[model samples]
Target chain A: MRALVARGLPVDFTWCEGEARARALSEATGAVGRRLDLTDRAALQGFLRAVVDEGAPDVVLHCAAVSQARGLQDLTDDDWDRAVEVNGRSAFALCRALGPAMGARGGGDIVLVGALDRGQTLPLPVHFAATQGMLSAMTMALGKALGPVGVRVNMVALGPLGEGLSRALPASLVEDYRAFSALRRLGTAEEVARVLAWLALENTFMTGRVVTANGGI
Target chain B: MTGRLEGTRCLVTGGSRGLGRELCLAFAREGARVAFTFRRREADAEDTTLRLRALGCEPQCFQGDVADGAHAQAVVGALTRAWGGLDVLVNNAGVQHVVPLALLEEPDWDLMLNTCLKGPYLFSRAALRGMIRARKGTILNVGVFSSERIVEAPAHYAAAKAGLRGLTDALAREVGRHGVRVNMLSPGLLDVGLGRMLMPHRVEEYRAQAALGRTGTAEEVARMAVFLVSDENTFMTGARVTPDGGL
Candidate 1:
């Protein structure tokens, strides 16, 4: 983020989890932050417009979702709807609202973050599967539509990188996962964030695509 | 499993149908958390999801128009929030218009380029941040054989694919030293139903171009996607692998 800000790219570390967190981040980074729900359509539009009004964002780092790990049979309509709208609809709103301005300005970059399982499975993760999959397709489609207008689109397919989920799992379960990895270890959040910065700065020509950052494990 | 893509989280564009679907399944089976996309084809996405679930993967899906920028940003944001970061991104989503050169719709060119080239650019831009922060990542774009030989496909489709190939090289050149690997995969004459639909009559003709006796399969292409995206692919960037059965 400092690197980007140094390069004249406006960096707003958006924090929608809660008001306190958003405020803390805003103060800490001197960047705007938001505390809103992912499912709120109107608010999404307003947030984007606000972003543009402030400085017409060159890139949007999407880092939000509603998720569950239960089986398909356990998922309810609320779960399904929430995931789709939050994961899929919310992203579209950003593009629809902010993309044209970026295009008109001539060559703006917008990268979308896609999850690890749009193509994989995780204990019956049907809801996330649908939402993540569409997110990528949507990115590709927009790549086609926005390319002419001068907006670049891309996606990042992410893997697991934290310790909370691991700590929460049973002892044997961790080993079960470890056995399948090439490095037999978990990844970290910082690692993922580093990759994000490089793509933002260096890989300008590549658009409408995805990048993987899993450790050998 | 302990597959080549073990411990990886890969997102595959256009993953619900044709070669994209196979790439999804193969990634999951290989122990990567695979994320994939489907355009207007929810059933195909569902089918792929159901099968991927059986493989012990944690697959998820997102809905939006890839041709729209707002949606593209949202997708990336959601993934980061949910997974805390991204590992790999595969730009496999694309479209082809069968119209003759004179009959091509203006929007058709946009659609092809958006899905094939522009979308990858979006993902690359967004994912690069996370990858650079981590100091390691992989970017893979799916290319068509027509990228090199443009005359075979429709004008717009071929042109868009050609641009994508160029973008692949450009990305490799720009970010090879950042511990980020970017590459391209070009598959020819896949054996999927869509492959047949894309050119049913030319199946024999397609097979004849490659040294292999028959056309390719989604699984074969998926294998390449896994390699380019796996931990074994640390040093490769802006490289293109033509997985066209020696074509």
Candidate 2:
């Protein structure tokens, strides 16, 4: 939100699970914030209808995801279902609801945010990786599906970053990730957001590609 | 020719028919003790078992849903208890539906993700325990070659299979130090199983795009699956080997 606002683009609407956070983000970016639970089909549909009524935004950036660090032995069915619903299913729903409108209106850009663990040498969240995989492939399929209409679909795969989710990871693991990267440091939120902004706003020719911003990890 | 997988214990999911059946036969021919799981199709399971028996190796067939963790654990448990340990596991069970994204419902999405993506995760997770303990094992995830190519009305299938590629890469990295090699085999349009369902014109369309100018056979892909899980695949891990006739 900050990246787009900083770039002088008015982000019309934003959403999150918590109302307070949504309001906070609304204040931060001057975009309408709606408290949305993506797992609820009715609520998601309502949100989609509302967005469509307001006219489909020129760019749709799907970055919302729910994940937990559970090994195979510890992961339960509920965990899998939640991750798939929130991370995987919601993206599909967004594209399904919003893609045609974008295509009909002379094209738009849809940027999916994913992880940079294409072949991580370290142990990471397996369930999260699976959903990222789903997102990546969907990007390819949608890229081709919507490309003829001028819409571009792509994914920006980010490596270990210094803020947000990485902050929740173990300090030791963060250190290990830093050493693993060729740049020997974790990326900043600005750096990742810049990449997302670029793919969403600036890139013209690249589609169906995973533009990895992993510091050469 | 000497058997490449002599004395090896192998398990293949969804082995009662199609590419899964072909993989079972290939492993048995290479001199491995074969076990397989099928969701339904008792007659086909019986036939596959008989075929394996003709190759002079006893085969076991389990009936269960690959997506269920308990079923995956039970299958791996039985195989490990009976054979001491499992050496190779092929995550091959899958279900596909062709529907445009606009018309696709939640059930359609769940079915594909459960069978194609979650099945591999559950089975691989169950098998990894023994593999990690023994410091040796190979897991081959069967994916589709169309994951990279544009296909109509297969968004769910493409997502699930491509997700398997993600799992393959991450799992390989997680277990490579333990000597458990994990790789993905994405086969292109073959004249078997799912490919048989394609319209003739669609088949021709795919052929025209391929360098080989023809769809491949399941046998050709199964051979590559064998090589991937065999000793010959010593140095390769976290790789996606596509046998798509150069599409």
- The lDDT of each candidate is 0.68, 0.79
Over 4 Å off, model 2: A1-217
Q: Write the per-residue lDDT of candidate 1 for residues A1-217, one digit (tens) a residue.
A: 5445544665776545667866765676666555767687787778888877766666766757667766768889998999898878988888887788777666576777666524335442678778878888887677666766656676776655454223544455456545543334455655566556555544433455555554321
lDDT per residue (tens digit) for residues B1-247 in model 1: 2476786877777888888888888788788887776678888888889999899887878766666667667777777887777788888888855677788777887787787778888878877888888877788888887776533666777787789888876676566555677778777767764366665556767655443335677775676566567774443355555545333
Docking class of 1: incorrect
Candidate 2 lDDT over residue span B5-32, tens digit each: 8988999999999899999999999999
Off by over 4 Å in 1: A1-217
The DockQ assigned to candidate 2 is: 0.02
Global Cα lDDT for candidate 1? 0.68
**Model 2 chain A lowest lDDT segment of ten:** A202-211
Candidate 1's TM-score: 0.53
Per-residue C-alpha lDDT of model 2 across residues A1-217, encoded as one tens digit per residue? 8888887887865466567877887878787666778889899989898888878888999888777767779988888888899888998999888888887887788888888526456576777778988988887787767666667777777777776666666678888866655445677777677667755775444456665656445
